[model samples]
Target: MHRILVVDDEEAIRKNIERLLSLEGYEVATAPNGQHGLVIARSMLPDIIITDINMPGMDGFAMLDAIRHHPELDRAIVIMLTAADERDSMRRGMRLGADDYLTKPFRREELLDAINSQLKKLARFNREKDNAVAKATALTEEKTREHFREQFAGSSFPASQFSGYTPDGSSGFGVSLPPESSSTQTLQATVMFADIRNFTTMAERLSAAELAALLGRYFELACRPVVAFGGTHLKMLGDGLLALFEEDAQPQEDALSHAQRALAASVGIQDAVGSFKQWVQEQYGQRGLPSFSVGIGLHSGEVTLSRLGGMDSPEVTALGDSVNIASRLQAAGKELGWLVVASIDTAQLAGECLRHGRQELVSLRGREKPVAACEVLGISAVPSLQQTHPPFKYDPASLQAAAVQNSEMTARAAKEALKESLWSLQSGSFQSMQQSFRGYQIIRKLGEGGMSDVYLAFSAAQKSEVVLKVLRTSLSNDAEMLRRFIQEYAVLANLTHHHVSRIYDQGFTDDYAYIAMEYLSGGTLKEEIRGRGTPGNSFTGSPAQVHGRVIDLLRQITSALNAIHKLGLVYRDLKPDNLMFRSEGGELVLVDFGIVKNVGEHTVGLMPERLVSTEHGQVIGTPYYVSPEQATGQEVTHRSDFYSLGVMLYEMLTGSRPYKGDSLNELLARHLHAEIPRLPPEHAIFQMLLDSLMAKQAIDRPADAMGIWRGLDILANKTGSLPKARID
Candidate 1:
């Protein structure tokens, strides 16, 4: 009988599930909550575990994490029980490795179906495992040894090419021969080099024990692809590894086939590493864990395999130009900001399987002539293992024409455009059309803020249009300004949210430091509001429609803020101007993280002290949307963001802001001392929400973004404006 464990905080629910499972002829164990379930699970080693999501001590997600980490309990089928409205909790449970989930109040049939499904899956997995073992057992000892020899030999040189060679008896791949004998063989093979990007920085940040554990996990994951694709795992070089694939006559695999396999293996390794990185993010969150990425390079050529080293330590290793070229290609990948790079030979041999970017000439250390290479975008049908900027396709002829036209058009067009909109002008000398910034061709100026100028530019490396934000050259020499500018890039680089703008690259030149990011052309939420006007005023939509739109925007805003706060950063500035809409997806992206504050760090204000009165003596935020705590210079938290968002929501619902002030000082005073204006009784629910969000005390407000989101969702549903589909 399949043993099942049922864990829930409610005794009635646990007993019901246990009784139901027992009736189905299964041995059922019960635990009051996740903490108790973990103990029962370890001792019983049940075949399946069904647990509730929210518990007093250890939650279902934590229990699932523990089970997955356990040696023997990891294979148990796990299912979660969550309320229908607890979407975030369910998602967290899934990421923590729960096999499936049943909503609270689920039907008996639904519960049984989920359990039966998991059992079916478990049976299939066991059958496959047994079949694999049986097949392996079918091979004779000598044949198994030959099989191993073929696998390793195919990854280096063909067996026929190594005729008359004998093992050196040192175990594994050691070289041994008669006292005076030394021999070498030459064969065509594909050599691949892969290393974790930014490993040195990661090592510096992590403890020795943590780093070793991380590397152990990384190597275990990184070698799977090589073995799966019939390549030999040669050796590990600290954070990097080398693998080889050689032509095989018996298998009828040629040099081209080996190259393709090597490329596939490289892609697989990238995929494996990516999965590991994601697992880390899920387990430990993003901030504490250092981010990880891998770079890979492949080259196919003839290399001499020989026995080398002293008499006592003779080892068999590849030595030739091909190995050097492969190593250089890996370095080139890192230099070009690419996950994978390949020589022209490898790309050509791999044919359709390789989708590559622009072909470039790379200067290798000892090579006199530059070698032609391509940035490997991905395999044709294989999805990228890493999440990063899309590969740029280089079109030399189009780029040349665009560059020439852009040079002639940008300066004149930008000046004319800025003259019509004062917001596009900053307090610095504008860049000329002829000037190039970080290999990007400035098409036109987009907009300008107090500290930086935004421009629409074409990135030659990415082969796409991007938004480039460059710090004012006049402020480049200012240390604090530079730190603030770099902080935005640093924070943005680590965030991966659909509603958060993606940053492609960041660098500094002689004149300015710039960040290249995703270009969203749909304008800002401020513009959207201006175009639509306030609800029941200039708006043309029906009451339900207008309310629905507000709900949608609120859902997105709160969701983005939730993700941002989870990263341990508070977005102090939450105005419509910083909320952007993407043209392609129509998703509102959070931008301009310039004033973002770490959760617990206390820092004095860089702005003028006269801005407002605060206990911390540092007031920094927009006047109209500033929270009371911000105005008083008190410590800010995630709740401060809700207050600002509340101000925007009020403006969206009505024709004007709740409070009015003639000057900055007056606005600060009103935010600190004035009473919130009452809304029309027709929208009482929304008014209550607004009042709660804009509460004077942070503790009086909704606890966090998630709480605000849930509140909005509840209100929207009651008001008949609940969206049919979730915004995220």
Candidate 2:
């Protein structure tokens, strides 16, 4: 319902106007004068304001001006009321931002018509506004997808390549690519390459943890500005970053060209690094660390965009002489003592004269000709731009000494690893019955499912151990299962997290569809629980030790689920058997997306689809661990997975499932109506989390996966089990 406020010195006039508008079903408020009216307007945020031109304490003109100044109230319609002969007063009110005017002794129809006309105008404006927002969003997404298609062309279903769509290309780069993904396209674009000026010396002096933290913080600071100015943060090359600004970028300021946007981003990066230098000095100044600074090089030219690497783990990066030129310029900046260097092509196309500290035709390696360039101090015309920092999904101080001993030069490695995997494969024909599932040698059958068999296989193509799942020969003709099997691969492709299983390749041969994924040999959480012998007090340790272990595992599990939930996808099946530890690292990884579903608005190429039919009381998950909502064949969501997490916690603390029965029907009924299982009296500190997670209603559960992760973090910190988390 729309609200209207009437202000006048005359009590009778105000009361009459209120009564009349109230009768029309409007929420009406009356004020004796402009001062009271302004108070009411701020409080109620009325849709329309009607005020007398003349008032004792603050006049209508003053009130209207005040309303216009309040961002929250400025959108409201204001109407002026004046005596019939006071034409000048009405004109003055109108000039002061009044929407309409009604003279005293006016007919009821005239007053109503004026209010209705203003409302119609406001409604029209809103419609146009909504349409414009949606159109702009659509255009931006299409532009990103167009670039993605250009980079990853020749795929049969090119649209499916990016279901994890982030306009800044965060997900599109350094994540999984489709099999047979060797495609490229050339386009005119502006590239900015940035690297630390004295990174090698810093690495030598600072401890490994110190260096990683510096790079992590620096990467966050630098990449944010590039994304802010409508540029693609394509890659974090060892101690350096490569970003692109295409001609098609939607300028935040319409007057700025793409080149100007790139230049502005370069300035923004330099400014950010300036601040970071101060932080480094404060952190390691006593150690006599070298001065901190960044050299940013900008160039504009034709560059090829492509997905480079193996089938399992592919990264999107720009390749061409232009990209190389930018890299060279960044290096050249070190010798010239320049902060930002721009090639003549970029400076000229930036749509404004750059503040050049020096200019020269410098000889560049690998090129016979010396290119004209300038040492850019700044761009006076470049306005203050809005920058954004990506989510802190990692703990920066968690960096260990191993990071320094054998880590990549781009030492944001931990945080970068948190932001998103490594997987490869070459194609080969099957030569023997035992060597089926092309390019992979099936080591042995690990387990059997109703529709498929899991095998520990070695991929000649990837040259790594992978878990190969091949559809059963009988179900080879089952189109639905085959589709779902492929769907599972599609779901895993977009999810690149350490706690989430990595997918390498997928193909159909020998009348069967198979997926090659990372091998987790540490076994399932179920096996760990079962190995503890009898049910009573399964975990054998001091209370603190047990609690510490439990918190550690839950934190890892929640982190995995957090990654899944953020993608707008749900891992519906969350049984203990489905969670396994990576062989290389002891970190738990969420596996088995056989029943995963895309259920949120931020969906990518994978639209909302019921992978399996849910008709006639069909339940999709294991009844023992399923949430009450899932047991009833109702809509499942990310929160539903939390319910399963609750069950897992109960079993880990105790030695048995939360709810048990002799038959399926009895078990499901218990899951629907059973009370939430409680932790033992000794472990009661964790009851709050368990109760909320196992609440019968999904709404009563923790709001999101990260909330639970943080809750566990708090528990760990309170008990002095784990260090306080670094991420905010």
TM-scores, all candidates, are 0.40, 0.40
lDDT of 2 at 582: 79
lDDT of 1 by residue, 584-683 (tens): 2388889988778776433222221111122364666776788998877788889999999989888777656778764345667899888877876645
What is the C-alpha local distance difference test score of each model?
A: 0.66, 0.67
Clashing pairs in 2: 163-605, 420-496, 424-462, 425-461, 425-462, 426-461
Scanning candidate 1 in windows of ten residues, the lowest lDDT window is: 160-169
Model 1 CA deviation exceeding 4 Å by range:
1-435, 473-475, 533-539, 600-615, 722-728
lDDT of 1: 0.66
Candidate 1 TM-score to native: 0.40
Off by over 4 Å in 2: 1-433, 473-476, 533-538, 604-613, 723-728
